[model samples]
Target: MSGAANPALLLGASLSAMAAALHLAIIVGGAPWYRCFGAGEGMAKLAQAGHWWPALLTLGIAFVLLVAAAYALGAGGWSAALRGLPGLRWVLLGITAVYLLRGLAPWPAMLLQPELRQPFWIWSTLICAGYGGVHALGLAQAWSRL
Candidate 1:
């Protein structure tokens, strides 16, 4: 399986890594779109609401995971890059679960609210489904190759 390099797997890993990097950059850059996630604008609200530390910690965790993902992508080599990552399959599995639930689960009441409907969850659902599916397929292909 080491020599059975699957380009799709490598490409999928690269895509996931790039997305993580972009997400981290957005958080660091104070992107307003992140307001919905308690990162930028929401941080102020969270601070006043007395839950700032937990939210901040969550964001920090996400950043760490993104960095780890990036490192895995780099370590994953040319022939079997995706398969090369030490524990990437588990990470991918976790990501897939989150995305699937976010995208396919019954819509939450908060997301149904008129004001937040447009940008909060609907778009995320679509993005998560598409992106998650791509990664899942990549994982599946890579696993099969392995």
Candidate 2:
């Protein structure tokens, strides 16, 4: 309640969270479906049945929640209100860092997994890094405001 909250921090967090969610949704959900239904009758049936719908929904929900959480943590007086919770901010920052590393790191193991194309992995990694940098910068600004 007493601490100041930076608007830029919240916006950055929100955008980062959204990007992460999108990456997860496509990579995680699409891979499995593609693996299970690789150009066959089963694949055709699954596609016709729209099994991917749930995955898309999940991504949408995650995006909303992440954005809301960012607003809560960084927008208006919420950040100030929760400023009493010192560890929370650090934990969020840690989560952001972890996501960045996971998204960006080049795991040799992935090369063996034919289901995931190397090009796709590289692109996703880059996107994650970008998102992480934005969020990190935002967090720093927010901390300073506090």
Candidate whose TM-score is highest: 1
lDDT of 2 by residue, 1-146 (tens): 34565565566556656654654554355546434423344544554567775456556656654743554364324555555545656665775676578666665556777666656566656666766666666566665444
RMSD of every candidate to native, in Å, equals: 4.7, 6.5
Worst 10 residues of 2 by lDDT: 34-43
Best by lDDT: 2
Model 1 lDDT tens row, 1-37: 4444445545555655666665555445443435644
Query: What's the C-alpha lDDT at position 122 in model 2?
Result: 64
Which residue runs does candidate 1 get wrong by more than 4 Å?
A: 31-33, 36-41, 44-88, 106-116
Summed over model 2, clashes come to 2
Question: TM-score for each prediction?
Answer: 0.60, 0.51
TM-score of 1: 0.60
